[model samples]
Target chain A: METLERLLLGHPFFTDLDPAIGRILVGCARNLRFAPGEFLFRENEPANEFFLVREGNVALELHVPGRPPLVIGTLGAGEIVGASWLVPPYRWNFDARAVAATRAFGIDAACLRDKCEADHHLGYEMMKRLLPVMVGRMQAARQQLLDVYGHPGT
Target chain B: MNASVAPDPMLPQPWRVQAVRRETADVVSLDLVPLAGAPMPFKPGQFNMLYAFGIGEVPVSLSGDPADASRFVHTVRAVGAVSGAIAAATPGTVLGLRGPFGSAWPVAAAAGHDILIIAGGLGLAPLRPAIYHVLANSERFGRIAVLYGSRGPAELLFHDELARWRGRLDMEVEITVDHADPSWHGRVGVVPGLIDKVAFDPKNTVALVCGPEVMIRFTVAGLRAAGVADDHVHVSMERNMKCAVGLCGHCQFGPDFVCKDGAVLAYDRIAARLAAREI
Candidate 1:
């Protein structure tokens, strides 16, 4: 299978998507590569794309002045990298840098938004798929914030 | 044959640490054998009150294989003074062992049904015995899967065993970490996230979860969402324990005693209490 077809067809987020919709997605997707320590995006930068991680890790980092930067999360294979593109002000909220050399399918967000507007079926399908990933990641972040690792000190 | 081989439940029996292996920065697994006394029997999910000769005692779960009668095993995370003492003890260190009291995981009842095991951090220690039991009798179960998560990729316990278990075709093993370094290429999320990644027949499945109270509550909710019945889900709960017996009341959860009625409880039995902010 072609890389485009495989990525669009195999992503859990796109499983069972209408082939037309998949085709529309493939039309806007482009392959990407990043070397270690390369910045995919910086804090407050334009969030024009979201990556379907194909290989390697991307560190979502929080930089605190006068202190070492902290990695909030790591995005890896079979995971979706950016959700900020789906929301406005259409700006990145954190620094995403390649922790290792990475390969991904970068989907054009503005293009996807335009496509969604032109086709309600595609828009609804995209919403149903990506919203779950957003919700799931938020829940995981909340659980991590709680550090529910056993009764502390027990 | 009795509840425990200890002549008296209040008095502690002496056990010598045969070996201690550091599992992580703060956690250590101790291999213990009775010095001169008879070996005490324990069931999966049961806990022993281990006293650091001079510091104090705390209830730690039995993490060893249930069928291995020659020694007892416990993985301790050094959180408090007593636990720190126990974790730092040498091979010849002598510690006090009380009753292995508590209700057990439904390993027997879960036979012939698919087994879904979910654990977080040290939660894996308590459920390790049940995993061993299920794998040893794999023919009796329809399917078995283990999902584990931790604070970070570095905090994961039993890394080697997880790899070995994943090598088997019969048992499905998945792991995730809340925070991970760049080197980690596996799932980066909570344990519950991996639940949907594995396959199990909810109609004929038994779910066992062991983690913090918050994690257990979320895990049970996830299992329910995945078509598992409330009655079919079980969780190992934690509370401060002063006495292994129910008398001290430190391990009380509403009317149920965590030390006596459970550390392992059916989801239906405690769902309401678990839902309330204060219990």
Candidate 2:
């Protein structure tokens, strides 16, 4: 069985994280798994945790009143899901469902937020890594809006 | 794939349409057989100037199997007047065609290395022939992966063929759409996002990319980030090709004529021109 410390240590997301910070993350992290088609989180729910996917895939979906949920994006093994935990209000913007049987590390958002509030060094380090992921997602969303494959001026 | 130039590059040979298969709402693939002499030999990335008799001529990529000598195939999206006429043609409709012009995908040069094919939207049409060649000679390459993306589920080209390729254990095929309804169980993201999802030795890999210019730009960046050299990356440039032989300057990008020097060229050769908006 992989211990929380070992798992957090091995993840790419913690590659350059300070040793103390890794230990702090391990304290807030716990193993999480979801069966195929199981919902990990829903839109408008309090974002209490974020996931570092260790295996399988997760689909981020948007629900419509009269239609089935539209899948906006997916996160696979080695990718992280849910940045909403970092912002104020901390509310999920989309529903995340496991596309396959998935294993991940769920890190408690409130626990980490409290620690960051106490330590500026940890907060800065986390911000450096988290900002890129948020920026990348934003850029991808912008590109999707361009509809490069569709007819021009659409 | 062979690349012998035609004797009269400007003269249009009549090719009778054997069948027309609609791939999408506005996209159609025309299967054509020669009305006179033997089928014109062409390479994977070469194109034909299809004339709609009374309409006009448009440069369309050859989208059929390079080994299939019975007929020529061109997948066209009804984007303009010339293409709309070409796409609307029925079986037995005879269309005029010029030489199999432009450079070809570097399948020969890429032997012994992993092959990465990235396509966006109808860009798959031009890369289809090269895909046929590579898969046919799979033993020559180390690993083969094809990453394709479209605006949505309905915009993807070569549906049946994509499934067939995905079934092969020797190759990897990953398809994504920019958007999808609930019915879609596959990926939903830009094509470049899939680059990191696949396995390839960047140092010993050759990448062939075809798509809208913006998509190509992003795909190139992803390849470079994965350690693939600029020279090892090739992109097909679509331009306003008036004279398929390069006499007209309509297809000129910087100093190279797309019809003559490319449709396919190494990324290093045109990195500056691709970044320039005026060019």
Candidate 3:
């Protein structure tokens, strides 16, 4: 529907996208809702889908032997989840669980990939938009790794 | 400086520890009452030099409500010998106290503007008094938000108080941790990461930041990126403090002694000092 297309275009990932490219992306996107505690995708599973969160929160987690899953990061409204879909071997690296009743637009990765392959401009645009998100997360993760809070000396 | 403080600032007055509450495995909050004279009234960002008998003295920020005249509350982490002795003291233990030192948070100047309080790790301990004052006088400010980040859930200070603040409708409180176990349903990320989640008019907002030096650097950068001017951002700096009075150069930060010029200072005043490697 045109309403869904417009809503999808408003997402940061799709914002400023050419109308033709947006329409192509909307074709592969569908509305999704998850109950609290529902797992959107599991680690080691095929990363066939990615999402643009419209409302609510999602936690990306990792499970360890004999331990509860550790939350790596949380994504909220207006943020994108699941960049693994863009890389080769197409598999999830962590489990994403809806921390609250959530609504999102799930985009089929294979469908978008085929479109990108057919049109280099669309592929270039997608890379241009997603790279920043990846770099931001990487930098934040690095800061966390520094354990800035627990340094022994003042 | 408080008017009631002893005229001889160098002399330590005896104060009795009224009670001790364990904040974490390594941190404790000591409620102290002056045994001789009136309790020294401290502004939100000021600190006290607490002497643990034969061991030594350490400068601790005032964490209690400013309105509470009966006792002074200090939350101390057992980082070294003197702090460990203070943290291990039981109720009724007598400790020597001096001060109510350093510049206070610019709560008056911050009126009519939004307030953003960013605290990381034990930095939350020093900022708690300022938060108490702001909440007690909430009508003077615009939107208010508190963003706190710790190493994890168990390391969080003031569990019940943080929950109460979160429940209030007037202000926003977002908490995050650098890491967490599987049971944590909250956010897991660096403190600066939460800045994007909250709403504030950056140009008209005043930011108060405290934490490790490295964390403060990153947080100030985040605020700058978010459009806040350097002058509007205030930071609490920690340094080696020996004499609570400005006479001892132990607390020197850049050209100013943190004991007198700050513990709380406008970020613009020290932006060059902070950026310099030699400082």
Best candidate according to DockQ: 2
Q: List the global CA lDDT of all models.
A: 0.86, 0.91, 0.90
- How well does each candidate superpose onto the true structure, as a TM-score? 0.86, 0.96, 0.96
- Cα lDDT, model 1, residue B184: 66
How far residue A82's Cα lies from its native spot in candidate 3, in Å, is 1.5
Best by lDDT: 2
Give candidate 1's error at residue B14 in angstroms.
1.5
Residue B258 of model 2, lDDT score: 94
DockQ (C-alpha based) per candidate is: 0.42, 0.80, 0.75
The order by descending lDDT is 2, 3, 1
> Which pairs in model 2 have colliding backbones?
none
Pairs clashing within candidate 3: A69-B182
Per-residue alpha-carbon lDDT of model 1 for B80-119, expressed as tens digits?
Answer: 8999999998999999998888889999999999999999
Q: Once superposed on the true structure, which residue ranges of model 3 sit more than 4 Å away at CA?
A: A15-18, A151-154, B1-5
Question: Model 1 residue B186 lDDT?
Answer: 62
Off by over 4 Å in 2: A16-20
Report chain B TM per candidate.
Answer: 0.98, 0.98, 0.98
True contacts kept of 3: 0.83
Error of 1 at B91 (Å): 2.3
RMSD of every candidate to native, in Å, equals: 3.4, 1.7, 1.8
